[model samples]
Target: MRKIYITLMLVVGFSAVGIAQEINWLTLEEAVKLQKKNPKKIMMDMYTNWCGPCKMLDKNTFQNKDVADYVNKYFYAVKFNAEGNDVVNFNGKTYTNPNYNPAKANNRNSGHELARYFSVRSYPTIIYLAEDGSLLAPVIGYQTPQQLELYLKLFKNNDHAAFKTQQDFQAYAQAFKPEFKN
Candidate 1:
């Protein structure tokens, strides 16, 4: 009975060791700082409090175990409030939401200068950055786990550079098979 109990506990502990239920999200600055020593792509979720799709993305897509695990392995995840009043420093520049209204924190607030710098006009945008903290691209709106796997693989592998035309991307998208569970 003692051996059985010890074996069971060991199995459970080992299985849980590599599985990720939640993403370890960091600030953009933190991610960038870590990138200097350990280079990995940064995936930023640009969201606002008022955006319904942003909430859904958090609940449905980001909550998936496979998505969380993949992100934790290949990228440094940053959850940034696109309309919040957080001061940010990036690429030798400082950014802030100078027009942010405290009363409208839950409603429509002023856009952050960082969001403007990234040209994020929509909520729930997934902004991908290179390992060196350079901008890769922005995937706008909500995405399911399976749907998001394509972009995750595309940027992680730097395959987006091969697409020289819209038709090229369309062809690639058509042939792509998602391995992530929904």
Candidate 2:
């Protein structure tokens, strides 16, 4: 009976550990507020409900333990619906989806003003923002765990500061050895 109790406790503890290894995503407002208290680069997964690649990114790259841990540790993760009706206040501007159609919520409704402000033309654009909430870059498309890991580390380490030209980024990409597996 004593051995069974100890084994059960160990199993429960291990299960809890597994459950805890996920990205702690926050709302845009929450992330912005938190940055004021504890500054960290913000990573926004700007996606629409109708995007197929966006769904794949959520299931594959974002779900990877290594990717989630690294992003959670170095950046305040935000999952923003680019077509949603939520009003976002950033950099002294209020953005909203004024043309959002409730009847076609799942379809490609008009994008939010925030998405247009950032010039996000594609779905699943991961927008990286500075600690002060300024735009760093917008990485468009679906990336595997290995592919996304490179950008995560590059921006987190501020390695992009050294790039003087497009060639410089290309060189860095060529030399990058992705350590994360899909």
Candidate 3:
């Protein structure tokens, strides 16, 4: 009986440790608010329910300890559903897709005005915004943990504005290495 009790205590202790290490995800409002106080850029993972790559990003890249640590440190991380009931307030107005028909299930939304505002043409678009609520850039598609790190650093350091062309970005990326470990 003592051996069994010890085993149970060990299991409970390890479970608590694992839960404590989990990433703390912030809501859109909370993230925006934090950005205002902390002076960090916003990195929003704009995802749709039907997006496969979005799920992969959540499971793979975002799950990596390095990626999580970097994002938690430098960004006001936000996960926004491209088709959801949440009303977003930006630039003195509220935006929502009241016409969203989730029943169709063919990867269609009621047409979020915010998505249109950002010109988001695809699923899983990662939108980066400056600390002052200015548009930075929206990158669409899947990116590995390492690849995502480059953009995180790029926008965090205001390098996006310096590199006006893809060639310039490529050159910079080639020469870049993370100054601090995640």
Candidate 4:
């Protein structure tokens, strides 16, 4: 009877842990539409199915509880497939993957038109956008949770706008303290 009680408690504990680790991901259009009522920055995760680092970014950083909770609170998260065939509309323009080959759906394919529009050159690029949907910057490559916190807080708090020079940005970086845990 005691073993059954302990097993039930373990299940409840694991279920609660799972609930806190999810970032509410939305489509680009959905996030933009929602911004009208509730203005929040957008953090777009641009990835491809074939990219190894993209998968790592998901399993390691995005899944981290601190990253998920902070993103859910301050930004709209977007998961966009850089090479997938999806028709996306943004900034009064419609974009599609005209060169998408279904045969290469799970392999290397041409870049989507939206990915090209944003000038995303590599996989696992986290593109930060303003609350009104304007582009801020692209953080390229895989970053751990603590490494990503710098950009997240800077953009969320509008701290990046204070930089008038490279040295200013360097100074900000030199004094920056990351709050996210590894």
Evaluate all candidate structures by whole-model CA lDDT and list the values in order: 0.93, 0.92, 0.80, 0.93
What TM-score quantifies how close candidate 2 is to the native fold? 0.89
> TM-score per candidate, in order?
0.88, 0.89, 0.82, 0.91
Model 1, residue 92: distance off in Å is 1.1
lDDT of 4 by residue, 1-182 (tens): 99999999999998876744889999999999999999999999999999999999999999899999999999999999999999999989999999899999999999999999999999989999998788999999999998899889989999999999989878988899988876
Candidate 2's C-alpha runs over 4 A off are: 1-20
Residue 55 lDDT (model 4)? 92
Model 2 lDDT tens row, 44-83: 9999999999999998889888999899899999999999
Instruction: Single out the weakest 10-residue window by summed lDDT for candidate 4.
Output: 14-23
Q: Over the stretch 52-125, how does candidate 3's per-residue lDDT look in tens digits?
A: 99989888778777788888888888888777667888867788887877684456566577877888878889
Model 1 lDDT tens row, 6-38: 999988996976443799999999999999999
The runs of at least 3 residues in candidate 4 whose Cα sits more than 4 Å from the true structure, single-residue gaps closed, are 1-20
Q: Could you tell me which residue pairs clash in candidate 3?
A: 99-110, 100-110
Q: Give the TM-score of candidate 1.
A: 0.88
In candidate 1, where is summed lDDT lowest over 10 consecutive residues?
A: 14-23
> If both were scored by TM-score, which would come out higher, candidate 1 or candidate 4?
4
**Which lDDT value does model 3 have at 21?**
27
